[model samples]
Target: MKVWFALILCWQLLAPAFANEAVPLADDPVVEQRLITIAEELRCLVCQNESLAGSRAELANDLRREVRSLITAGKSDAEIKEFLVSRYGDFVLYKPPVKPSTWLLWFGPLLLLLGAVWLLIRTIRQTQNNANTEVLDDTKRARAQALLQNTDLPK
Candidate 1:
């Protein structure tokens, strides 16, 4: 009975050894490689700022699996990307292609920066011009002198 109890304890300890290991992604490493390559080009919809290949989000996993199947079915990388783009729109592309609709997206910041720089230069030039043209007329100068001379504030 003591031997049986010891054997049962041993069996319990060894049971985890029988637990299934994580299955290899697929039967083909090439498929996994292609999946990673394609996924790297996609943005994770749920993660917003993360790439599908690097994100741990559930949606990212689903997209990876979808890519894997597309690869396995012999779709070229470009075709796989097009498929995703068709389904998810340009937002799924980390670097969206230039189009009439997206021209502002690509160049708007540069235009805004140029505008800000021009405004700053104009403001600085205006301030310097105002400072340089500080000739007070005689009457205004006399009034300024009178105010400076009268240091007492009204009670």
Candidate 2:
């Protein structure tokens, strides 16, 4: 128990050494604010599902640094975005413009949903029609009656 207590004390003493330092804030708060705003509107190229502002990837950090430099250089938000887009293409933007090339991306899910709904309706109608047109011939009806009347059958 004494050895355990000594180890625990040592662990507590060394815990601060293992801790990570806080990230230094940008010199200009306005530039940081603009970086966040623009980054949130942009997708992280390395993490396709994550926004640039939310991603912790190395590429995300580098992109943030690049954006900060652009802000320092007095480029407008639009110009900064245009520059990134020119380098990385429309995939960098969270909301890419609807153009001829992006028509499939914009409308694919909606088209698939409509097609599925139409198929479901058609299948249901076909099933209903099949059920309605099913004939109960004498032999089949007698067999059904016999099954129904069998006392040995479970309820």
Candidate 3:
């Protein structure tokens, strides 16, 4: 039993040494730097809120590799970006240009916020108007006064 335990411990200790580790994206520092710069301007399609430079998703890694290869092939930043846009649409860009098709994407949240504010204001005004218009009859008012007088109020 002790020998079996020792063997398990040895295996666990050596497991990491035998495991394959992730290598750098590129051998050239300049290429890697350019890749990072371009990646920061691109969005990770899988993780919508994250930049490609920060995402660890498989698709993000694949895109990074693709971008690195483009850089190695002597493509300028603009050309690489244009290529990606042609393939993936403007959605891949962190800030898509303002165009008729993308107006809703940029302005939808503002429109929704304005609508909510308008609704809230209308609701509050309606409630105030309803309260102001309400009238209690003399009889009901007298009954309420009598009930209040008869009840032992809390100190």
Model 2 spans > 4 angstroms off? 1-23, 142-155
TM-score of 2: 0.78
| lDDT of model 2, residue 147 | 89
1 or 3, greater by lDDT: 3
How close is each model in CA RMSD to the real structure? 9.0, 4.2, 4.3
Among the numbered candidates, top lDDT falls to 3
For residues 18-63, write the lDDT of model 1, one tens digit per residue: 9755434968988887787777889999988999989987788778
Cα lDDT of all candidates, in order?
A: 0.87, 0.92, 0.93
Give the better candidate number (1 or 2) by TM-score.
2
Native-vs-model 3 lDDT? 0.93
Candidate 3 wrong stretches, greater than 4 Å? 1-20, 143-155
lDDT of 3 at 96: 94
Candidate 1, superposed: residue stretches over 4 Å from native: 1-24, 137-155
The candidate, 1 or 2, that scores higher on lDDT is 2
